[model samples]
Target: MLEIGLTMKKLKLKESTCAICLTAMKAGQGHAIFTAECSHSFHFHCITSNVKHGNQICPVCRAKWKEIPFQNPASDISHGRQRINAVGWPRDDTWMTVLRRLPPARLDTNRHIPSLYHAQEPPIFDDDETLDQQHVIAERDVSIIDGVGDPNSVGTIEIKTYPEVSAVSRSASHDNFTVLIHLQAPVTSGRHSGSSNNAELPQMSQNSRASVDLVTVLDVSGSMAGTKLALLKRAMGFVIQNLGPSDRLSVIAFSSTARRLFPLRRMTEAGRQEALQAVNSLISNGGTNIAEGLRKSAKVIVDRKWKNSVASIILLSDGQDTYTVTSPNGTHPRADYKSLLPISIHQNRGTGCQIPVHSFGFGTDHDAASMHSISEISGGTFSFIEAEGVIQDAFAQCIGGLLSVVVQELQVKVECVHRNLHIGSIKAGSYRTSITGNARMGTVDVGDLYAEEERDFLVTINIPVDRSIDQMPLLKVGCVYREPITKDAVTLEGASQVWIQRPEIIGAQVVSMEVDRQRSRIHAAEAMAEARVAAENGDLARAVSVLESCYKSLSETASAQTGDRLCVALCAELKEMQERMANRQVYETSGRAYVLSGLSSHSWQRATARGDSTDSTSLVQAYQTPSMVDMVTRSQTMLLGNPSSHRKLRQALSFPAARPQPR
Candidate 1:
């Protein structure tokens, strides 16, 4: 056994060249290498590029790859050793004899092999590299809003309007058109705008930013007994550590019932220690009572005496709700869980301020539908933690956005200015919308705006043809919100009108790529919603079909506008969604939750830390806050008290690389 192990180690050391790159794979080199199940090693970028281009087979062996390799090749050898130990050596065979008898594996070098460096495919590598550079530039742009004018200025949110086309046909009796409203919050130097390498919490002074009042509602049910509960604790610790002294935190645990483990208090050093202690005391038992948990969390938020603070709730659960009522006959489960959505009612009883309730489905068994609905109703994003250990990354992403909020109680209004123009409809994802003033004006209640966060609203307008006017203004858009620093109301309406030229010829009207991208996103989100409903109803085939149709539609758009990053990303997402839906095992285990949460994220225009899909153009990768990306990259090393063996296993399984850039 020792001789065989030594021989294998020597062989691994000797195999220094990557099959795809045909270059030395050495430590401390710039590029990372991945080993496939067939033991064929290639550069990580090379394999990823191959997979992204719709090739799922190994480059050298043509073997179908089940999953992308994201770990160090050394781990495979370690796993091999473990398997060898599990199936103990034959008693009759000696280790030296077996080592001598084993023959060296042969590589069929005569076979033609495709290389990324091939002359015919030289553009592929360059295009991928360009895409990666574009992603970095996009992230930098998102991190720093340059045209804000004043660096010290706070509470500045910019809004831009884009029309589908610049011209409308005068021959038609009525012209229907789409308009997009894009809103962005300014980034300030006082806040953490870019990514960080260390997982340590940032230090803040007293007057840096708005104080956050965060309530964590956790599920401590029997289903979350062992590993789930432990990860939750570690995640909570990371959360607590991230908050500053100006922030206030409250902890609530639920199973058959709910109780507050810690009251809302400023996170001073002492307060943080107490919160950590409370988290450590959690024990899993009883059935899941998600409603009770939310109810308690709402009560805590309502009872808080603090004023002028940024407040929200983070609810995490691992199972379906066991909501029941006691009657004279017997205890009975509730007929519907929708009636238990208490977020709106609690908001009314409080200061009338909107409180976002970000909910996370911990594992596969959790009710994703209920969680998504809960978040949508409360103007929050729903995240699906399909894997056990990634709960920390999800929580970190949610909290990172929360802590960087720049504006509150944001409201956007679109009013038809022309007499002939009328509002058809507005699509603003999960945000609440209302039509007022005889359907001429539409209002969207966008609860909060994070620094550097972008949101889009698509509005359809009905225009009556009029040859008398060469150009006409159709709609007037405006924004009203409260600045977090001064708690003062600010209204913006500059350059918010949409106008179209009434051309007699009606020649080819130029389309706005930005507007078209957003339109495709809204359509894709609707399709995802349909697929999610079908899957939940046990019609996997119908769900798969719906996603396939959507993918086809988006793919056409993507192919036409390959330069549009958002459009291409949406197409990739739809393709991934359809592939997951087509597989029965994947859909049931993690796909259902993934699809539901992804739909919610899309509809709500929020980013999540769900799957580790290495697609660089993915919305999650593009929109994720820098702090979120950093924390997710370093989650495995964030030690919370766990058995060394368990930690080692987690470290081995955890992919240390950040989501790969395009290259």
Candidate 2:
């Protein structure tokens, strides 16, 4: 039977002495639970107060507890405690032995804990002070200042971690973890345990298998004038040239509007060159309209009837929407990028097409809030191109990240396997699975599998594979995308092959969840910031309206995924933040007031048409806003005195007549 722990084992506490009582736990009688990678364990309850959200790490070792996976029992022979907490097969003797030993709760608490795992070496600690005490003091002293709401804050989203084949499982037990297994493998020459008997296990195939479909959407907007636009073009060129035969590509460009430069096409040499030509033709004009742009690109995939491929849309934009078209009833504005939902798109699934949209933020002004929402809704990736020159590399990385589905409806049947291991949620592109049934040592079908161009399984199992018993249980995995006979409807079938080994825990779920949480929180903060900006410009109604919408989105997202306490906190924090911004009166020097006042008074003339009285007169009515006029004069004053202020002032200037028409 598979055995899961009854309680969460606490990592060793960091303080040399307890903060409250100033004494360590009683010796032998109290257990000090150490994390798997580091020789640090807390006195069960010492670190709870410091937890901000989710799992906390050992203060001294910096070893996070959640990354450690559950291990087997036989390996824990030396640990006198009846309960065995097996880490992965010993990489080193010291690692195995040290983890196997139980620390004297009282004395070991005061001693320096060495890094005993081969994977992570002990950290150098020169100071004599207890690390935990110092850490607590430092953390507490850190001012709980308001989070930054700068433009960069709105557009920066980072992928904190990438998925790896082998990693720790992060599932809490469902009905407690326990398991039993019985395998039926063809007998071969191998030692059966320690007895003088032979055990034969089924020899399974081990061939590398993979397929991917990637769609790229780019922003060709006026704001991307210099380095930003050039970098993006170079990046697209690199992606198209290096695409493998097994991969497929589609290209779309958005200016003030969205256009499909190249429809979803195979990555053939000619097709790649044609797509490259399309990419080369892209130029900056017009404004940003990411919502409509994404909608149109997604439509291309639907029109072409592409399905079951590792579908993804990569969007690169540097600003917010200028104009948008929505439903006639105004229930859902097509132009509203922030609240665009998958269900809205799915309902209008004009054709049978489903593709994930991954987004990449280019500059500091890129609308990360909108891009992040699109990515999360589509169950795709999102990242930022931090430096200026690395655009091509960024695009290449996006292309390489797509998943390729080989087998359609894959289902694995393990004949005899039982464990208390709780199966976490499974994600396979469009195909997903949920764990069900009794925890018994018998047959079980997990889910379907997908393949990439170069075949690899993106799988995550709760337990390690080495814990196999009874000649390694047969793993039958298969898929059914379409009926062979009818060739119309989706169907399923048994796999002709068996997985010789356990699927690795790629940790894609955890990564996706974590990234989503961080991005959403940042997005909520940004929307609030933008609303405040509008408020500062004397647009109180717009500020109130936008903040209300942002609050709702944040609240709903946090509710959908219960673990995100930060988003929930931020949601409440935003209302307070916005109120403060609203309370601050917009002075005459504010950019909007200054600009508006000059335009109304006809004090500022259009540089391009200084003598065109007719044009100047017409523009004054549209451009004049008391607030904007005041701000522009102040900005001009600053620009005249300071070179640095020129760029900032330039950003505030707008010439409607000089703007080019959208292509």
- The whole-model lDDT of each prediction reads 0.63, 0.38
RMSD list, candidates in order: 17.8, 30.9
The digit string of per-residue lDDT tens for model 1 on 1-663 reads: 422221212123443654433456664454444665545565554454344334444443333344542222233333333312111211110111221223323333553323212224221111100112332343344335543553435646877788877887776655458888887776644654433533343422224345687889999998886556756876887788777766778788899988776567666555665566577667789998888888777777665555335888999988878764334565443324357755442333123466778889876778776777677667677787766656766787787777777777888988998887778888987777888888899988786777667788888887786878888888888888876655567888743788878878787666776676777777788998898888878898898888788777876773235545565666667777877777677887668777877777777677764653443112244366443454454444342212121122111111111221111
Question: What is the TM-score of candidate 2?
Answer: 0.35
TM-score: model 1 vs. ground truth:
0.70
Window of ten residues with lowest summed lDDT in model 1: 85-94
TM-scores, each model vs. reference: 0.70, 0.35
Error of 1 at 203 (Å): 7.4
Best by lDDT: 1
Global local distance difference test of model 2: 0.38
Q: What digit string (tens of lDDT, one per residue) describes model 2 on residues 583-617?
A: 43432112222212222112111111011111211
Q: Which model scores highest in TM-score?
A: 1
